[model samples]
Target: MPTSATLAQPAAKPASRRGFLASAAAPLIVPGSALGLNGAVAASDRITMAAIGQGPRGQFVLGHFLEQKDVRMVAVCDCFAERRAAAKQVVDKHYGNSDCAVYRLHERVLERKDIDAILTAGGDRWHAVMSVLASRAGKDVYCEKPISLTIAEGRSLIEATRKNKTVWQCGTQRRSNPTWKFVVDVVQKGRIGALRAVTTSFGEGPWRQTGVPTEEPAPDPEVFDYDRWLGQAPWEPYSKLRVRLWRVNWATGAGAIADMGAHYFEAVQWARGNLLELPVEYDGAGMFLKKPGINNIPYFYNVRARYRDGMLLIMDPAPKGVRYDGEEGYIHILDDGRVEASPKSILEGLPDLSKLPPPKGHWNIMAPHIRDFLDAVRSRGTTVSNPEAAHASHVIVHAANICLRLGRPVKWD
Candidate 1:
């Protein structure tokens, strides 16, 4: 890994997998939920669980964990009272147990010894804090995407999880899917031929920042724990735009980079060998297009990450969609479907895809990822996309945001 003027310490070489695992070893402090299972039961054995930030994404995570038979929904937490109660109701209906506790603050949930694992689906700002707090409290964590707002925060989250000996998974569910895995395998194996470039396009772009319009405030305004919500960031007054669409504002979010760029940037890096300490250079921009009902400028965005090895990664939201180009041919991955090289003998020239196991069902992937974390709790196996990998992807996205904001090509340090 290399570092540039703006980046952190020069990227250090990573230890071997074995060395990394040995270094991660630490004493485990089992939560009550994990201990109560007695280590003698199967998936049928009950494992109590809790959720923090039970908003839209939070509820979805709760549902995923509930799919495992051994897991029992034990607690739900959220700053928003309405959302918290809604998640609690869902948990009760699924578990048929109304006794499960619900809390307005996440710290109370973390303090509970009965909770085995925590699903941290709070806003982007809360992602790293909740994960670090939960891990310290002896709970496995399944935190949602973009893991952190900045590269520094991501590094801290990864280190804290290792120190606490927590089995953690960043919620990039696509990583659990087989088709995407197959795509990555193809790119890594040079099936696409000396991978020269990758281009990713997210769905248009998010709303842009315009000062909020004045309006009468609600009577019982949802008094969000602004200080707690701000956590590491400075505390400030609440606004509809900040509360509803914070991603566009830098103070609360990383705009599209931390939001959408996280997904495609990760896909690109996973396809490549690894992320560079810094890119050779970066260039991109956000413009507002005059589309009906759309107020933001530059609804479209694109970035080109030039690498030292001549390999290029282009991220753009365009009509042409996502594609990877190589010396021999290219692969196009689109919403409708995937199309590999059409040249005769291309499939024949590749390694035996048939030898690998076929993809599991859609819902099956997350279950296995969850099981992988659980197994690692005892066996200490490496997670598929550990915090290190997540952080690397986050760094790339962070750079992209810098370019979009400055409206100038950024030179990586």
Candidate 2:
């Protein structure tokens, strides 16, 4: 739903052996001013990092990492030649250094022992694989969600990160929103009284990439790496719309249910503190757009996820926000940045975190979430949205998709 007000502001592939080794091993030297004592704050303790996937989203995240002092962009990798060069240009211009390397294969970037962490967005299907490989490479990971294409993949991602003992962050950045967090506290802290059910409204269809033609076109494998872009996902012919925004492409993503659902779902998981488990059942129905029209992804969906506690999560397409109904009253967190309640007094009486400090406005929603990840990378502490929690949220959304596709309710363990 891109429900976070901050997100309302705006809006990759792999590589080879010798080529990979050379590209990944590129220099990640940190400036002396950023050096601190025990961890990344100090000169020698700086975090040398690589960015995988150089699309708009990839570059968007790289923009965030670039502004941080103690972190170095050692290398940039992507399937697209233009993106690879563009990302490197941004980094080089910022640092006034040409040491940053660009690579077609992310494997080489991972192989580099010099990199301490990675900020990656390698598409939905490649998420688990990219993260798992990075974890195994002894690097901390900041991955965009939905974290996996399937429940099994999510499980594997969790296990891999746990085994590797690496810091992991799921890019459900709304965890940093004070108002969102306050609403969750209101629900869980009994301020709402005897919670009954939760309702989520997210826009349907990520609407295929714009300016795309009606038919598939000849792909340039050399420049775009079509095969690598599709990766292990169900194969589809090269289409202009596919890679532009995989979140809307069924071959690469699970549609809007998983796209916008990732953010709104995390709000539910956070409020209920149900990040480690999924609902007991799923009942969903949706109609998809005709293939070759506005992309093959589904266009509309209404799903109900029933929890073990008899709480129902009603998901719809609209308005884009989370609503909680309790015996006493209902609290609605609207995407328009307003917190409404049946009894305005309820919210009026409750203390909002606005006064706590730092101020909440614009600030690019990912700032706090990314900040949390960086801090954890230093302290080795748990992140607000850890892999376990992220996986659980992904499972709920994926299960909803499964239910929609099957045209029947599903039983969840």
Q: What's the lDDT for candidate 2?
A: 0.79
Span of 10 residues, lowest total lDDT, candidate 1:
1-10
Candidate 2 runs further than 4 Å off: 1-41, 208-222, 290-294, 352-363
Instruction: Tell me, by TM-score, which candidate is best.
Output: 2
* Predicted structure with the largest lDDT when compared to the true one: 2
**lDDT tens readout by residue for model 1, 212-320:** 5233343242445545555566655555544665655566666654665565666677777674344668887777534332133344577888888887878776633
Q: What tens digits encode model 2's per-residue C-alpha lDDT throughout 1-413?
A: 33222221234135568888997899988654565634435657677889998778789889988878768887888988898989999999987878687788787788777789998887888878899999999999999877887889999988999999999998887778777787888888877788889999885445534345345775676588988888887666677755565666556776677876777778887787766656889987887655444355556778999988888989888877889999889999876556778876667667764553233343245677888998999999999889888887888888998898788999987
TM-scores of the candidates in the order shown: 0.78, 0.84
The per-residue C-alpha lDDT of model 2 at residue 194 equals 85
Quote model 1's TM-score. 0.78
Predicted candidate 1: what Cα RMSD to the true structure?
13.3
